[model samples]
Target: MVQSLAGMMVPADIFLSWGVQFPSVLATVAEKAAEAAEADGTMVLLAVLLSLVAIYTASKVGGEFFNWLGFPPVLGELVGGVVIGVSAFNLVVFPETGGNADNSLIMLVLSATAGLDPSVAEPTFEVQSEVVSILAELGVIVLLFEIGLESNIRQLLEVGVQSLVVAIVGVVAPFVAGTVGLIAVFHVAPIPAIFAGAALTATSIGITSRVLAEIGRLSSKEGQIILGAAVMDDVLGIIVLAVVASLAKTGEVDVTNIIFLIISASVFLVGAILLGRFFNDTFVALAEQFQTRGRIVIPAFILALLLAYVAAAIGLEAILGAFAAGLVLDETEPGKELEELTKPISDVLVPIFFVTVGTKTNLSVLNPAVPENRAGLVIASFLIVVAILGKLISGFSVFGVENINRVAIGVGMIPRGEVGLVFASVGSESGALSPSLDVAIILMVILTTFLAPPLLRVVFRDEEPEAAEPDTPA
Candidate 1:
């Protein structure tokens, strides 16, 4: 049968009665490849949309419950993140988190619900996680911009001298106390000690600014000083980070870079405000020409993004630029219109920033059951004390301001938040810090961030609560 079949001439287009094509096989292959790529891209977008669903659910439920309990909604948003994050349900874990996000409950649900291919699951989750992270970052940027819009520039300037004092003390005291005590008592090596000490100097401008705005004290004299000091601390924190990073890489600090960072930060901030003032009239005039759907907001957002980009290029925080953009727009005729438009956008995005801050935190580092974590807990205790007291004391360092809630100023600077993570990450990556010391810094950051919101409310409880969610500057 095989010989007969082989001998038979079956082709030649079935003896010229039929035809088949073969050369387009490569084109077919390419078409299938394109389809697969498109499918994968769609899956990534689906995954991101699902993640946002979980995020928004957590944020709102947590926020409402906490707000009902008479606490700051930000606290609930954080706790919500902790619940859904790597520490708990794994619903919103990041990719670097041991690939747990790919196997998270949300991802699994997505797979089961969508008939997602197992082969593409990993890449989809990775891309989804990254997109979420970028959105979270944008959230914080918008938060800072909104804050800058609400703040009184003249008021901040009024407390500028005091804020400078507070920022300097906040940086120096913790850095000295934590660094010296570690070397003297723990006998930690110089580099690890310095890196850990550097961790103490960060003040979460995002957290403090949100809390101040919530309690309606954002326009208060004390609030102005705290926000101003926090911004200054951010610039100083970057400088310290640069110095320590240089030391870690080369065992030498860059004096010239430090000087340049200082000068550039000052110039960037001053120039942003000056330019804003210089262009206020022109900005307003330009706005009058646009008669489109986003007439009021599009221009303002463009300015914010541009300034944020310039600030990053100059080695300063992008939020500073966004904040500067807000200040500039606030001086324009469209200031109120811009504020109204920004609120809805802030509502959508800012919660992602708060929630993600909680998600990235690994509470496992504080487990006393683990012998390794025990040492971290012990060291964390010391750092916490130093972190809290060092910053609190700086509030009292504010001189010539009578009847100021010096404690609030200090407490405002207490939360290390995500800024502390930058230091810990660098230390771990450089091998400058032992696992135990790294964990200790994480604990300090977590506790300080968790504690500051309630503490701020307590400190300001005596004062009348500012209008909850004030739409205009006080």
Candidate 2:
């Protein structure tokens, strides 16, 4: 066989193998290699940008589609995330989602292509990343602050027993369930399992709020209970996160640290509320005096940033500070303007946060061929069911509230939104939970989020009162 030397060429697989082997070579050629490596980083950023754009556009498109089909818009968002996440389309690379991504083909490509030249791969701030962090923070702040501002303080006061019951069940069930599941089923150590349980204790109010708003049930009595219970849940979640962090760091749970965190969080929350109330008048006056439009925005931004820092210093999340700031603003007479101004920032920052979340969901964990992996998958499903059922039972707390649909309220409380993701992220970063556990948590969040709207619609279809029948003049 006389074959010309030119006739034989490098196989496509060989070129890929070469890229994997001599990563630096691709970056060194004519500096084309370097430029190309640099280009990949740029490509990553571009992919993120495109993801953000896709999510936003998808949300809109999904919303319309769902609206037309009489389904929840959130469902559409979930579908959008899943569709983009899976192999149906390869528009964006799914970032490592704990254990699941390592098995993914997309990640295989990302790993093979990761910064070919370390010399040229120095991380730089993309406008997108900054914008994403800010919006995510702002949206969270607005959401929490709005909850505080909109809180029916008087109703909470009046129905103290009910609120406490709801909060207690909501916190205790998940905590206990998660711990037992980890220890008994997964055979994880008790301490990590406890921390895992604590992570699951926090109820994400944002999901329920959005669902209620979507179904036009936000003003109902059941809605109020859901809101109250969720706020209480957030307070509980923070306490749990602080405790778990202390335990993880010290390698032993400390009652003293728990007490200290509770005290600190309580003081911060109460002080912020009082300060906001006290300064409500002053803030209004200052807003009027400054009149610079620009002045108010800057001052507000500074305040948010300052509080966020202080919150961090006190060993709490910075998002809490932003939320507290929102509450303070809500008390001021000029709050409406502040809300309007905050919207643009939210519009810009929030989507990045969400898409960033979606980006982290690794689809490869779904593979069962990996060893001990079946246990992880089973755990994921078990956890999701436990998470859902536990929250669903909390709806029974509306014992005497008039015109309340306990079912609707319970259903409304089902969705776990950004806050759930926060817990999952904390779990992943701290190594308290493995990628398998991460998959479990994420599945719970997605399931809850996907179920809320449609379930709420079903529960509220008849508009029956939330309360059981009362005795007549007995």
Candidate 3:
């Protein structure tokens, strides 16, 4: 390719394409040779790989330290990302986060050692950052799929009415309180406030459920209530996101499109699960015939990714499809085996999701010394208060269970997790949220996420711990 493109100014994408094979020290050195051959071309592959190195290093170190302290490892990963991301080290900064070749340490390392040209640094960082972003997105998808696999639909159904009430209140309370407060009190516009309210509706089922599993309460009655409600929250959150996204995009709400999203999302989730169940035996029989290394896992992976794509294509989040696929496959005979096999993949990919969320956060706005930042802090405080109080009240809405852990249920739903980041990103990209408001939303997300796990441990500490469900596999 270098020989073919010689004497032409090589595009950044050529290096990006070669980035499919992850770069090594050898690859970095080889890139110097390639640079020699194609004088006009510069390598971004090394920069990209080095960024991932920083990401993984931060994830593991933070995760381990947090695990040691008896907090969620995912929280540590987020903090580690903040330390290395735009907020601190600049080693893992993204283009959207005011990071560029001039600011990124990894890109500088490449320019110094890998012969990456200074002139192409920005373009290189753009491609490299976009790749990292895509990986982070995939990480969340895998995390949700894993959550789905672990979940028992029967348990969710057993607590269906309570979960429904909790989910509805959990969503409505935060949304109404946030939107109205932002508008009537803060004087923010209706659209941006609505978007912010929608952001509040997310319950990071990934992190919350992960915490429940880590603490051995995952199959408890309270845990089941939280899980079922979180799933419902995911569905309802999508509808709210769609409505706001449409309003933001066109400045006019499309009621017709909104209805379609609601119907399609419902039908897609139910139909996918039903279809997966109907075909489970056939899938198992075909896998039994293969006797191959990845016979079960590979097909399961394909189904997950395929369904994820379908969900996204039909105007819902891709994670929904991946999750539905997991729920379906969990009912199959080889479910446990497939889950064990899938763990390694989830371990490799899911940290990227948590860490990147931290990386994109600029908590610098919360500083009290800066007068402009003070306003953001005020708004952030308002949001943080409403966000916590609003969701915390959701547990009381759960009806008719003896000695039910209402506080535990509310605390479980407090973490908006990565899904809140999705809402903020959408609003930011669509110009719906002002920078101050954006920072406020981010603060709400980060604090809520970081606070949930320890709070869960604290809330459930006094209760007689419920035994794990007999049918639910660890």
Candidate 4:
């Protein structure tokens, strides 16, 4: 429109003769305004705001439903993400502005307008993407640290062989089954298949822990085993991610690098154990010295973040570092005070982290026009079975541990919340997965997380009778 006005004008001298320059000024202002608007787009910001509102509302409704159904709120959170991304209630806009429905092209154009040349843009964006990614890394660290603090290290060690076996089975079975489904069944190449299996490897210990605590079984032997197995599962899962990621990047899975990652994780685990034992007295002393209000809590919080950062710096995930730090803290103090102090922080930040996960989910990937899709859904369905069965087999690991039904504990720990989704996201970002494949992983995650709790309630309902009757008469 502004160009039309400029074209219609014969000459500025005509306006000057009439002593009115308003038309020329209007044209210049309009042209500049249009140019500026095009340059500085607010599309992403608007889309984010829309998503935030939608997520908040969905979380509330989803939370209630999941809670009533005997599941964790994380299940609802996952569903909330799925609703926004895949269901009729999509919260995201295609271009996030304008009527253009081609988001991929829009993203490319917007990124190009921001000075990223197409040839160089992929690498540049991958590098810059690390900034937002640090958030998830931190979340994992904090989650693990909390687990460490809640853990009974001595007890976990006592149960080490059994827990290790469970963890190994938990990791291997799912990976093999999932890989076979992706490759033999779905016929994808080995590298991508391995990536899919890797995504299925994580077990959300946090979700399992919360549910165990809720059911007053945190003190049970079965609970202890589940917690221990989950810790090991995370350690092993990350190693798989590192190896698979390297393989995907280089097209060669280096056995030496895989061995090195495993060794590093083992070294870190051992180092954490020694440090916790050696400095436990010092930690207790420091807490005593800082008994003053507003002292121990802040320092401890700082310690968690510091360790988390250091972990990231070393190429390991921050969540693992946070968990290690928490393990090092002196939990011998009465009433689990360290955990009580940290709960407030976790309560506030953790939900935001999960909600952000929900926000990133794009549901439109289920659209029919998406390419190379059959394999993705087929693999996801197969892996969902493998994910459930692998954890279920952990129940058999309870043999010879008296008074506890290992089956129940295994079922309780089956839900894969943020951890599994994190794997899916990493795969998606690396270009190793198609959009439909990403959706399949998301669906598998949602299915596993949603089904676990209610199933657990039924599986363990029989345990009450065994508990009621002691082996020896009272």
Candidate 5:
């Protein structure tokens, strides 16, 4: 029977008829299935999963490639994001449709079946994009927490007057440069100018610390000063961000509110440190009794998240809380173990945050042919120059510290990295900065982040090599 059925030759007309009907039937079935899935909200889940796969794959490959090239892995991740994002390949897109709407495979499939125009259709927010955005935010929180874990409050105190001077100068100079350059030179409004300046006050400890560690100079005197100054910069930067953000929201800067915010922020940080110290032993003891896996790590992570929530609740950036949690967790008996466990988590999330930041950057404004884009490029150029010079001058602030490569320190402080991105994101969301200004800020961030690592390597080449050691807190 099988042989008879296999050997049966269909008539040419019948064969042609089946072949034509097959695709039509299959397409009909698929269309119905898709409609059913949409009704059940399954399409949203599928889209989200697809997005995650795409984002993580792109970020990992990009990060690894950059690492191989001897640059910071984050730079590679950022570049990769730009390559795959709407501004480049259009592999991923947001709710709005236009431009590369036709280029995105997912968008194409949806648009075709829905009878939507790729160019003119208004797309609704997919569940997947929202989830991706939330995860990206959590990634930043984890990144800040990891930074805090590596920091030692005692070491920060030990760096003393030199670090203090450097930190102050670093924060103030950039703030002045950004504000003055935008307002006086670019003729930007006062509120937006303030936001731009606040962005410059940020110094990415993660970038500078990683560079120093890679060069085996993390424990050097200059490294110590840079770390200490970075810590101070984080504190000052957050305060400035809070004040400026408040001003942007209220349309006025209240002196009383600014002073209160500064005091509140300081008290919260110090209080968190003291509270963590007091509870460290108790938490460790409790963790030891838990027979289940991830005892120490789980509890520590919860603490970080809890603090982050509290910080956000109190009108401060959640990163400050995450940092404080790390500081506190560092004092635990299982601190080293917690750090080891947390490293893998950070390894996954941190790159996602960086890549997401890169993807959000609109490269269209940087085009030179368009008159408006030309103006934006000019503004970006001026901002980049100011950003570079502002931090460069801070390296010379340490007058009393001898034998320290001030140039290296200055270069070390130059990369704004994730911190600047955060500042710009906040400013844009709050409507404090115009789209052009935001793009300019991102350009400044990208240039500074990319420039610092190479410049630091060059500046440190003449110095004697320091022995590689485990990271110590500062």
Candidate 6:
């Protein structure tokens, strides 16, 4: 039935192109719709709307299908986006190449103008791209915020020592392994090497959190440690990014600037948590006066956005601020209320984030048949192994946490996802990394993100009952 329904939805062109014609009225309506779309400058708008519908539908179907297969739904969403995006079917196309104006819708309009007036087309394609980018950014912020809502300061503090060790090891091991391995074995340039190393330092809290949530383990000890470690990893990753970006720009690392960045990030996170705790009740009291249905949600979301903005302003990732916002709100009288209210929004936005991440992954770079790209494939493969080993080693760093699944914690930290992409983007823009190196990093992100969820499921599946069982006499 499902296959038949899908078959019916295929365009009539496939079967009727030989000689068939629509009824006159139907043809007229279709013609008029096309003409109107072309005449009123609504082509871009129509494309955007259709793109959203297609993405959401595909994401839902793919996610559900993946879930049915005993895997995390997000894996399916990512795969769905890749299938629908320019990387596969080219159904939802972006500019063929980054920063080339030739693919802009405005440029097409300008061409139609025949040089009569070039100024008429105002780069509408760029505007549309920006809009989509903003939406993707919002999706990630809300995702982190949701993760934060599920976590509390006490849980973070309780796992503080172990998490700290895990985070430090996670960051240092990957960075050192990537930098040293690339330099010594691959003979890569120093700047690009550093960018690769910096990229390795990121742990996608979004991916890890979703996997834990899917498995109903978000409140487990391993979950808490992974979450806490991811938060620390974010701070450390951003600082490393800033330092590497500076080094790339100046050809030398400035010690003072790196110190300042670290201090600023630390203060921002610590300060946000402290301030949120001190003033959470006051904000909750103020929110009580508004008797509307979304009173709690509206204020909570605004705070999340505001803090996210502040975090971005301070050179940290905006999602960090959003996470901090969640941590702050999770302690208040309205904390649980806010989570219940904001869940619907997260549900809509978070899948878009994962899908967008998928769309950005260009699998063509991994084609071994392409001789030029084979080296990149080799580099990416090596970095991926390094990436896995680096994070996996961090799990065992927790000495005192007996019976804790250190392997689960390590696997949870493996997916680099959007954060690694961000590092790669910055490096590419800075000219710090060569195109091959950038592609390698992207491939690393794709592999890590794709593999972590299933590996996590395997690690955590049987351990749940064991973890929950009370201590018994042998």
Model number with the top lDDT:
3
Q: Where does candidate 6 clash, by residue pair?
A: none
Model 2 lDDT tens row, 142-216:
544444444434445564666667877888887898889888877887667776677566666655666566556
Candidate 3 residues lying further than 4 Å off, grouped into runs, are 1-42, 204-224, 238-251, 418-432, 453-474
Per-model C-alpha lDDT, please? 0.76, 0.60, 0.78, 0.61, 0.75, 0.72
Q: Estimate each model's TM-score.
A: 0.74, 0.71, 0.82, 0.70, 0.83, 0.74
lDDT (0-100) at residue 294 of candidate 1?
A: 83
Query: What does candidate 6 score on TM?
Result: 0.74
Q: Count the backbone clashes (under 3 Å) in each candidate.
A: 0, 7, 0, 6, 1, 0
Model 4 clash pairs?
A: 85-363, 86-363, 140-319, 141-319, 144-323, 145-323
Please write out the lDDT profile of model 3 over residues 16-74, one tens digit for every residue. Answer: 44656445533644554454453323365676678789999999999899879865576
Tens-digit lDDT track of model 5 for 208-260: 88778878899899898898998888777876776677678667657897788
For residues 267-295, could you state the per-residue lDDT of candidate 4 as single tens digits? 76568657656666766677778857745
User: Which has the higher lDDT value, candidate number 3 or candidate number 6?
Assistant: 3
Instruction: Tell me the TM-score of model 3.
Output: 0.82
lDDT tens digits, residue span 211-324, model 1 = 898889988888888888886786577557656754675454467865666677667767888988977887788789887788778878888999988875544556668877
lDDT value, residue 295 of candidate 6: 74
Candidate 3 residue 261 Cα shift, in angstroms, is 2.2
Query: What range of 10 consecutive residues in model 5 has the weakest lDDT sum?
Result: 1-10
Best-to-worst ranking by lDDT:
3, 1, 5, 6, 4, 2
- What residue runs in model 2 are displaced by over 4 Å at the alpha carbon? 1-119, 122-160, 190-195, 202-220, 245-252, 398-405, 462-474
lDDT score of residue 91 within candidate 3: 91
Q: Indicate the residue-level lDDT of 417 in model 1.
A: 67
> Which stretches of model 5 miss by more than 4 angstroms?
1-40, 96-104, 109-124, 214-216, 468-474
Stretches off by above 4 angstroms in model 6 are 1-41, 96-122, 187-192, 203-252, 400-409, 415-439, 449-464, 467-474
For model 5, what is the alpha-carbon lDDT of residue 349?
80
Alpha carbon deviation, residue 432, candidate 1 (Å): 9.6
Q: How far is 138's C-alpha from truth in model 2 (Å)?
A: 6.7
